[model samples]
Target: MDTVKQSLKEASIFTHSQERPFKCSDCGSNFKRAADLREHERIHTEERPFSCSHCTKTFRTSSNLRQHQRVHTGERPFTCSVCGKGFTQLSSLLKHKVTHTQERPFKCSDCGRGFKSSGELMSHKRFHTAEGLFTCSVCGKGFNRSSHLQTHQRVHRFKSSSNLRKHHRVHTKEKPFPCSVCGKGFTQLSSLLKHKSTHTQERAFQCTDCGTGFESSHELLIHQRVHTGERPFSCSHCTKRFKRLSTLRIHQRVHTGEKPFPCSVCGKGFTQSSSLLRHNVTHTKERPFKCSD
Candidate 1:
C-alpha cells in the first residue's frame, strides 16, 4: 500500500510540474518518468513483454494488450452518434465520423485527390513519384509497394522444380475446391467463388471513373488503370511496357525466344498464341478477311 501511494505521489508531482526528466535516445520522445521511458524503448527494440491471456498475441505496451482484448471480447465502447456504428478504438470512431460528414481533409498535391486520412494521401503520392523501393531479384521487376513485390516474388517460387511437382495436378485434371450449390469443382476456392458468381450475375465492385461493375475489387483496379493510364509492368529487355504482368511476360518471351505455342496440325512453333492461331487457319484454307471493292 505504501509503494502504491509513493508511485501515485510521484505521478502527481510529475503532472503538476510538467517536467519530463527521461528522454528516449532513439526517437527523442520525452517521458515524465523512467518507467514510461523504459516502456517506450521496447518499441525500438521490438520487444513484446505484455502478452494476451486469451491468445498467443503479444504487445509492447499494457494499454495495447488491453485494447487487443476487446477483439476477443467483441466489446466496442466507442460509438458514433451520426450512424450509431461502434468501434473498438476512439481513433477508429473519429475516423469513421469523417465519412458521415463527407469531408476529406487530406489532399494529394499532384492529382488534387482527396483522402479521409493522411496515411492514405501519403500512399497515393507514391504512385505519382513511381517509387520503386522493392525489386524482384529473379526477374529484376520493380514495384512501388513492398507488398506488390512480395506477391510478384511468389511467381518465381512457383516456377521452381519443387513447386512444378505440385503444379502437375493441373495437367492431371485435379479439382480441389468443390461448390455446394451446383456441385461444380475448381482447382482453387477463388475460382469456385468466381464460377458461383456467374450464376448470380452479381457485380459488387464498381469503378468510380467509368461506373463499370466487376465481380471483384481486383478486377475494378485493373479497369481503373485504363482510365489512369498507369502501366506498372515493364519489360527488362526493352522499353516496352504493359498494363498487366501476364502481357509483360508474353512480351518478354519475344526477347527470350520462348515459343510455348505450337501448331498442332503442322507441328510448327510460334512465339505467340495469335501467330499459332493464324498458322492453324492456313491448314484449314479459310480466309477470315476478304477485300472489299
Candidate 2:
C-alpha cells in the first residue's frame, strides 16, 4: 500500500516538474524516467532483446516485436471506426483516420512535401540527411534510397531495374523465358508469349506495306521499317544505320572492339554469340550444317 502511494506521488511530481533528471550518455537526450532512457540507449547499442517467435527477426522493444508478430498471425487489434479497415498498430489506424478527412498534418521543411502522418514525414526527412543517402560509386551521384541508386547505376540509360535487365539480356544473351512449343528461348516473357501465338497460328498484327503477319504490334512495326527503309538506330562511330537496336549495338562493338562472347575451349573471344557457337562446333566436329547435293 505504501509502494503504490509512493509511485503515485512520484508520477505526480514528474507531471509538475519540467526538468528531466535522466539523461542518455550516447545521444545526450533527456528523459523524465530512467526506463525511457534505457530504451533510448538501445538505439545506439543496436541491441534487440525482444525476438519474434514465428521468425528470425528481432526488435529493440517488446511492443515492436508484438506488432511484427501480428504480420505472421494476421492479427489486427486496432481498427478504424470510419472504414472498418484493420491495422496492426494504433499509429497506422490513426493515420488511416486522416485519410477520411484528407488532412496532411505533417509537412517536410526541406522539400515542402506533405504527409498525412508524422511517420511518413520522418521517413521523408531522412532523404535530406546523410544517414539515409545512397551514393553511386561510378558517377558519384547520390540517391535517397538504395533501390533508386541501383536503378540509376544501370549505365545511366534505363529508368527502372526491369527495363535495365531487359536491355542487359541484349548483350548477355540470357534467355530465361522458353517457348514450350518449339523449345526456343527468349529474353522477355512477352516475346515468349508472342512466340507461342505463332504455334497457335494467331497473328493479330499484320504489316500494311508487305502484307506479312506478325505475332505482336512491335514485331509488325520493326518489319514495316524494312520495307520503308527507315533506319531508326544509328551508329555512334560511323555513318551506318540499322533497322534494329540490337544490330546497332552489334555494329558499335566493331568500333569499340568489344568481344563479349568468348569460347570456353580455347579462351578466344568473338563479337557475337553466333561466332562463338560456330567456333565451338569445330572442337566437337559437329557437321550439322552441310551443302545439300
- lDDT tens digits by residue: candidate 2, 4-95: 99999988988799889899987789988888888889999999999888878889998889889998999999988888899999977886
Predicted candidate 1 versus true structure: per-residue lDDT over 1-293, tens digit per residue: 99999999987887899788899999999998798999989989999999999988889988899899998999999999988989999998987887676588888888886767655555556668764655889988787655477677767777578566556667888887888888888776678888888789999889988789999878888899999999999888867778998788777755544455755764445657888887788788699899897
Clashing pairs in 1: none
TM-score for each of the candidates? 0.44, 0.45
Candidate 1 regions off by >4 Å?
A: 1-19, 25-29, 44-47, 145-293
Q: Which stretches of candidate 2 lie over 4 Å from their true place?
A: 1-7, 108-134, 143-151, 156-293
TM-score of 1: 0.44
